[model samples]
Target: MHNEVRSVDGGSSLVQAQYIGTVNQQLPGPERVVPHETPRALRRLVGRNEQIEACLADQRVPLVVFDGLTGVGRRALARYVAEQVKDRYPGGAYYTDYATHTVDGESVISAALRSLLRRDGVRDEVMPAEPGLASLWRRRSSGAAAVLLLENVTESEQFLQLMPGGRDWLVLVAGRVESRLEVREVGGETIPVEPLDDEQAAELFRELSGLDADPDDPVVAEILGYCGGLPLALRNAATLVVVGRCPSLPELAARLRRSRAELMRSDRGPNKGNPVFEATYQEATEPAQRAYRLLGAYPAIDFTPPVFDLLIGLDEATSRDILAELVLLKVLQEEHGRYSMHPLVHDHAASLSGLDDEETHEALARVVRGFRNAAYYADAAMIGVERYRVADAPEIADPFSGDRRANGLAWFEENRRALHELLPVAEKIGLVDEIWQIAESLAAYYFDRKRQADSLSSLRHGIKAAEEAGNRAAEARLRSLASRPLTDLEQFEQAGDFVRRSIELADQDGHLVLRASVREFAGRYHDLTDQPELAQQRYRESIELNEAAGEARGEALSRMFLGQSLGDAEGLRELETAHRAFGELGDSRSAARALLITGQVRVRTGLPGGVDALTAAAEAFQTSGATFYEAQAREALHGALVVENPVEARSHLDRAIQLYRELGSPRAEKLASENDGGLDGAES
Candidate 1:
């Protein structure tokens, strides 16, 4: 009487039914449990020679579960073993699909009773309504050995409930989800069915379709490799060979290659029962097919719900549901809250989405734009330098509002791999602006982490893209970003080369800001190489251009560097101007640097003492994670403290000397050592 079936959590089930019958009538035909269909000819198939021998061994629970990915022939092997073990069960064998059954935790007892009663040839007239179905099913199976074939089961709840209280019956459960099932005593056994080994695959291939020679033969191996160790693919590829459609082994390989190639071109195709993957896709519904195709729109392997919602035109819940279905079908995979499809399947999905070359480019462009925007917002927050900015910006609906840094960092980290792969494609498609924008956005993350190589590679590609696009302004800007990493790597000559090109490009394009910025880098290069005169000249030029262009911030930076070249006292003269300009731009770090510079000048001239100025500088540098500058300030502070007390002086001097030496700044280290020696001499 109780046949109303529903999912335990009110979620949609693949099948649902509500019963209205009150008599508890034992229906004869339709209500009986339907057995899983097994391929007929595979029952006594040759070449499971080892498995047949294994099943003949004495074991209490002689059941073996065959499990594999979609289209790998788990059912075929299971049926073959079932046929061989038929003589062991005196009461005959029963085949049923536990996968499609909706028997709840409470109803499993009844469902098992009905299934057992139907097999026991008991009529409804003698069966009682009460004492429950579990009691009735157990009584019917009394004093007999029963064998059951349970197919496509994913959960173990139903199986555990129906397992005969005694150990007389042998039960075999097969499905793709074996990870959830745990076996215990009463002669527990577990066997995982994997793709056939190459040799076994070859044997199955020859025995089933007459492709007999050594499979290790180069040509045969080539064909088997195309099958991807799946029995269904091998069977289909063999069928193609036997029918003279693709006769030679090489031709069959070609056919599979062609099939895969085509799978990548369209989203849907005839499941030819041969190419394994095509047949699997043929089994999906329209919604599942759409889900499969839409997954291709996500270029990164770890795609979140927000991205899927944005690009796939589906709501969060709907997308998750569809993705779940695809996961069950082996068309998609869910890992750590993100989704991914296999490369082969991804290509097919991309092809089938009806996107032309131009549209694909456009879609990729949108994704890149979103990524770049996130990167830009992160960079703008971290550093005040606005390397690149797009006009007519879209509104940002940030999900992780409380912590923008962590969220942006995570997004960049997740997509970093995919972004690297997409760079070449963007360049090939002539999206130069996009190329530079993405690089510029990631610059802060790379620079802050001291990933010199990554920064250089990104900027180099960005510069190349800009040059190819004939964008002189962008080229100049990219070259400036590129120079920092080159300098870090001590490729001074290359760094200087980029600075020169940026200057030329900026001047040619009349991009005054870029021209001013490039000149600042040139000045830095000159200073690093000990060409003070040349450094002063470049800094002066940058100052003049920045002033003329009304870029107060740029003007301030150039003048600050110029003052530093002149010496500590002179550097303080320009600090107030630099501070005012940086303040106007709301750049806390630059303003802080200017203040620190002013403090250093005061200390050098014995006005406020070097310790005070250096302490302020250190604090600013620490706040910004400016390790290099912070170390420099610490070194200066150590020098100032050298004269205060001998013990403290030696401690500061020794530490400063070591840090400078570790940084590979010989000039800085030599000065620190000189101070240390002077302190030692005085102390002695």
Candidate 2:
């Protein structure tokens, strides 16, 4: 009887005994674990009714593979089908885009598994390592009724890694037609999503363009033929007409014909290039054309207007106007004020840009510089200027001027995906200094967001970049910071090596602040490994070096760690001193951290006022947007109140669980599991 069912009222109850001849058993709860929301289907989906009906009718099939060419609406069809059938699966509906998750052509299965488990309330602390993730996913997903929508799947192996070990699950996979056979072998029934028919294409175009022209018009017919019935192409052609890019349908048709001729001559085959995209592109002004070409060189999937300006070396208003024009022409897509090009359009733009290697390099260099500078400034604003930043903040107009902290953090959040995508591009373009500096600037934000995997990846790139440039100080700083993520991931051996290398480099460089930072990192590594004496010794060394180097912030941080490791009255005093120092230095985030540590020690030691300290720390963390630390403070408050104040303790525990859940932290599961029985008892 591993069948524990949670009732709708949120209570565990055994099944009726009479059904099993007086044998009492609990049934598993119907858990809804929709990790990623299925993308909404197109409102004006003109001609997929048959495919949708077929998919909905086949309730017996475990896997359905929707295979088609790029931009043929495979994902749209899959999404529509999943939305229709999701209610049938009580467990949950899950969605993942393989294009965004893959690295070097292989799926990062472990990351996907972690996402699944975390959404299922599995805490990171108790979750098994990468080697055991796939088996664990199968075990946990066994017998669960669910729907999984996997988009851009390259091969069958990626599907196998995510396949649920349940008979009642429906997995909808969308990929290119070439990937259909391998998936078919894995019990996936193929459903080919083809291009629209002429009538359907006309309907969709009319819907998108809002035009009153007859479908039988020769120019309209010519334009539709040039589009080849591809939904994306149709949309582009229709958008051009709607935006008044041409005075009449005949003019648009003539433009498309001319562009088609140019494309056929330049491309490998007549059908190889999209004439709709070419015509729309050709209609753009000179600045917009240059912007489109340079944008293709931008490695990120999406970017803001400021980033576009940086890439093209234009004023903000001019860049935004260009983006608006492209968006109107459907050459670029704009969502939430972020502009992106479709894969086909991006390829066409890149191929025809005619930018020499030097121009490409220069354009990329500008982008890297912009990112590096913005990130460094944002980091300083968020964390304060006391921390040793190896990169110099140039005296430029601050993009995040008013309310620097909030704006800076918001900018980072908005651009996080693009920033991550830019790292490798920077490396490839030989922007070595920018690579390491961007990594360093992003370190605090990454840590706060609990993006350990991303942090480690960027740090590795930064390390290589630093080494290539033969910059010991930068390498040492990056290595020191790298230890944080490695330690967090429980890779102590690797963390220790990074710390050791950082220390060696710091010593050779003879920069006291750098030396102190690396020593502090060493102490953190030792503390995580439970080497208390060694940790204390390293912290003390760090404190002395920081004092000598006149780095007050570094000294305060080391003191806070020293106090936490010591876990005694003297440690409490040290924490208090560090908290005061941080307050005086205007580092509220660090002060809150110090208070959190102090509160935790007090709670563990059964000291008075521990609840008060933890409450204050939680409030500070909440206000400062330090979500991870806020969760910790809440958990600590629960610990301090669970005995005498069970009611309040449960409330705190619930809040902590919610915070951790929002963070996708593994601790959520552990905390929920530990408090489940007690909270139920408290409620009764």
Candidate 3:
């Protein structure tokens, strides 16, 4: 079922609507285009063509300020020039308009950035602080020739927060003429946009009016003269004539003559801009206008037609048709079927909508539910049911279809970025179960990609959501999932807390399988924290529970972990059994981990088969794509082989160090520690 309730034509609370705007361009989503906030191409720029060409060619100054008195063509020139040079910037030429500037520096930067990230499908959360968010954006677009046109900026301080760290990045700031002094102080080239001369004014008037051989037309000349050679006023005057509301340019010129002083005053920009928009809007059909206002209520910068349907309570085809009309009217811009209205247009439409706070929240609530459903299906598909499985999960309409035709992993691969952005909304709306389920389900995908921080973040969100929902099982599972990353991070204190909480919850639940599953994490925490004896005991208890429940995977995991703590003869015995169990169960990764542990124990005991065991283990890790641990296993082999086959040992050392460096591990230090120390000397 399509997610909708209220029609764009009228009011219906969105909360009652079940909206799921899923499926779009390539899965994880297409790369973001820089916001060419104005028209993409301009044939002529009046007198500003030379200045625009100069700005386009300049390479030395990374920042350029287009300074002008308020009705001059500062914005038009910057946008025109950026489009000309956009191909040089593969990262994109996005705009950050500041005409709505309230003089709050922090809010200005945050709001603009929030807009861009949403355009990038980073919907859930962005970095909380200005510097951090700026740094994140710099990192995402690092080394790319990206351009940012900051329009109507009143203060240089506002630009500082959003400065891209890249030395070669282009920042074009358009503001009042006086702001040029500060802009110039910051290594920015200042281009002052003076009023257009008669020739330039005639060219602009001709372009706006689409007239041939008419630059010197007496009536057009008279009207253009009243515009004070300002492009905005000239364009506004021309648009009035083109829409056929006026009989002739001469009549409009006479009306402008009556209010000539008032219209040509310092505030002419607003007087020209607003009425042009209002007149254009007055001619739009009801559906297009309603779709315009309805979309203005959306918090995100860009959205697809499916989302538009959900928001406006219109069917997909009708919604898309209306969206096309708005795009035609230039109230919105559409690229590859996604729609984004200019900020100024959005603000105007939003003011006219008269939708109350309740309606806005209701609209957003539907979005949250839709997103929650997508996450739930994405979770199940990416991670499968065996790990941190949930029951009674509501499925969204599967736009991706069946498992064979669909790809669970690809969904996460493509959609994870969007999902991460939506998490904050989940928290805001209190989708408690959905939050934890989505988080816990992401473990397999996050871990496999070596995204430890993302895994830890999901777990943190899951823990809070589970606690809020009073879901003991979810809390236990989420905490267990958290322990692995904490251990990897060497954050022993937190890992210990996570395991202990998980164990307590499992014990209270009194489910043997759950307890067995969770105790493996307890054992892992003990091993990571260097409490080997305690680890062995926890593993034994877990093994006993798994054995009784006939859970072969659980038994094998507990035994493998126990072997690392036991060492020597007992270690060999436990590891051999675990390896056999894993192989029998067709779990290649688990079997490889067991073999690696076994190889370490064998080398310490001076076993003849140690080299062979370590070699096999390293190869398994390589096949399994566990690169870092494979390096460590190679280091262990090098330690054992150095006493005999020194050449092979040196070869192993080189490869291990390379893997360490690639994985960003302490390469030389880890190799030195393992090669010199080996495993423990017979562990008493």
Worst 10 residues of 2 by lDDT: 675-684
**lDDT string, candidate 3, 1-684, tens digits:** 455455554564554535546644433645555554534546667787679778867475778877654457777787777777777776677777764533555577677766656665564433346556666666665656678777766556657666776777788776643345666676788786767877778777777776541547887777766776767777666666677755477677787766543332233344443433454466478877766666666655567666677767767788777876665455665677566654345545666554355555566556656656665666555444343363346654654446511366566665566556556666775677777877876776676555678889988998999999998988898898899888888888888888999999988877787888888878877876788788888999999999898888889888887887887688889889999998998777678778788888888877767778888988987865667568777788778888788888888888788786776655557665665524442110
Kindly indicate the candidate among 2 and 3 with the higher lDDT: 2
- Model 1 per-residue lDDT at 676: 55
Q: How would the candidate models be sorted by lDDT, starting from the highest?
A: 2, 3, 1
Model 1 has an lDDT value of 0.63
lDDT of the candidates, in the order given: 0.63, 0.78, 0.69
lDDT of 2: 0.78
What ranges in model 3 sit over 4 Å off? 1-268, 271-384, 388-410, 610-684
Candidate 2: misplaced stretches above 4 Å? Answer: 1-276, 353-356, 676-684
In terms of lDDT, the best-performing candidate is 2
**Model 2 RMSD vs true structure:** 29.6
Evaluated at residue 127, the lDDT of candidate 2 is 79
User: Which residue pairs collide in model 1, if any?
Assistant: 236-274, 267-352
Ranking by TM-score: 2, 1, 3
**TM-score of candidate 2 relative to the true fold:** 0.61
Off by over 4 Å in 1: 1-280, 290-299, 314-317, 330-337, 340-359, 384-411, 563-567, 575-585, 594-614, 617-684
Better of 1 and 2 by lDDT: 2
